[model samples]
Target: MTDIGIVGAGAAAAAATYVIDGALPDASITVFEKSGGLCGRAATRRRGDVTYDYGANYLKDDDDRVVDLVSTFDDGLVEVAGDIHVFDRSGTVSEGRDADERKWTYRTGLTRLAKHLFGATDATVHRRTRVERIARSDGAWTLTDDDGGTRGPFDVLLLNPPAPQTATLLETADWDAAARDDLLAATRDVDYRTVWTAVLGYPFELDRPYYALVNTDKEHDVGWVAREECKPGHVPDGESVLVVQANHEWSVERYDADPARNVADLADHAAALLDDERLADPAWTDHQGWRYALPESGLRRGARTPAEDAGCYVLGDWVAGEARLHAAVRNGLDTGERIVHAR
Candidate 1:
């Protein structure tokens, strides 16, 4: 029987788990996630009866494989129907070009994607277990956790962290020094766009023609503003929840600032761009800081060669060269199939 271990519980990891489980049903799979929640940056949260996807706005129907995979989980899927308006540098809002395509999320939340993928497999996911180190011996990999516990002897290992974090892991891994150094060099140069997201809720409905507003020129402080009401069952009939994501520059500037202050600033920006004043005051607010939001570059060609040759694999949206959820899922599916064939 094959023994497979995966690090991080993001979209790619979930997709990989789903594919690997289907291809190799007899394999023993184990996953380690540092955080309490799954799906990484494609995060979702609920406040009282209102559910919202605060990180990734929604998954697009860009890949046929992803479409087929999600189709199998019809009970958890919810298609979003609305237009996305663009806010130019001058603060004028217009309809966006991509709104013609369909957007999707889960009925419960985006996390259901991860839940459904993992639920289909016999894999055991260990949440809140941060892997501190990875080493190889006897053609097997051993993982050490931050809690001083060790788990390992797996035939294969998969890493699903962001590029920078993955670089750190490669740097500390007790593997071939030259290969590790090469991977570190390549991954270190994979730049990322940081984002600070704020979720605001109101007791009354927000009447707007568009469901979202994005910064087309990238000159605005807010990168995107989306309404939770666009997704069915996310918001109460009479209430609304607005998710505001700050641009890279603004997010980097205020990432360490007070959450209340940062959220207020985003709400203020949203009010101006949406031409609505009531949005400046939200009944409840939630905030999250994504240090590594989207990857600016894909994985270097030579970066994965060394790992793959050593029975290790790296998968993520960053590795796929596109930060979209569809890209990540596609990469994971491809990587899982490659692993299955390789074995």
Candidate 2:
């Protein structure tokens, strides 16, 4: 059996695994994920009766291939109900260029997208298993977790973490130094925009024409505010949930600040932007800080050759040259096809 190992069980990794499983049904696939959840930044959380997606927002149906892939799942898949409005740095809201593009998320949450993809595969996913080291030996790859547990000598290895985390793994990999160095440098070239997210819940309802309001000008402290209730089956009747994301500068500044303070501050920003004082005092709140939230740039394609030749593949939004969920899935599909072709 061809042994395949994957690091990070994100959307891209799940897609790749799905494709690989379909093509090579007997391939033994193993995955290591550092977090408790399957999807990385395409995260979803539920508290009581409220479900919200606080990171990466909705998955846009931009790529036909990704659209076709997700449609096949068909379970719990949902369309975000309203259009996206825009706001200025001064907090003036207006009608945005409501493009006809379809925006999607699962009724359960965006995380269900990854769950559906991975669920269809035969791959074994190890959640909360942090891989600390990678080594190449005897024409195979091996991984050691933080707990000192070792997994395989796999024939192929796929990395799906953010560029920085992937680079860290490459930095100390016991492989051909030159090849590893080249791949490491390429991974390092990717830069990210941090995001501080606050999920605000209220006991009442929020009636708005648009599902979300985005800052057209990047100068605003808050970057995006989305209503979770816009997605069906997410928020229960008469209860509103808002996912507020702070801009890169503001996120970087207060990333380590007190969580309560940061949540209150973002709630204040939301209150001003929405022109509702009641929003400033959310009945309940949750927060998350994404240090490598969005990639500002993609990795250079040529930099991947040496590593791929060594039986290692990298797939993610950064490698796909776009920071969208669809891009990540598309990249995963293409990468899986490439691996199948190589085999």
Q: What TM-score, computed on C-alpha atoms, does each candidate reach?
A: 0.98, 0.98
Q: What is candidate 2's lDDT per residue for 1-343, written digit by digit as tens?
A: 8999999999999999999999997799999999999888999999987889988899998888998998899798999999999999899999996567789998889999889988898889999999999999989999999999899989999999999999999988888757788889989999999999999999999989999999989999999999999999999999999999999999999999999999999999999999999999999999999999999999887888888888899999999778889899999999999888888
Per-model C-alpha lDDT, please? Answer: 0.90, 0.92
List clash counts for every candidate, in order.
0, 0
Supply the TM-score for candidate 1.
0.98
In candidate 1, which residue pairs clash? Answer: none
Q: What would the per-residue lDDT of candidate 1 be over residues 213-263, giving only the tens digit for each residue?
A: 889889989889999998999998999899999999999999999999999
Worst 10 residues of 1 by lDDT: 175-184
TM-score of 2: 0.98
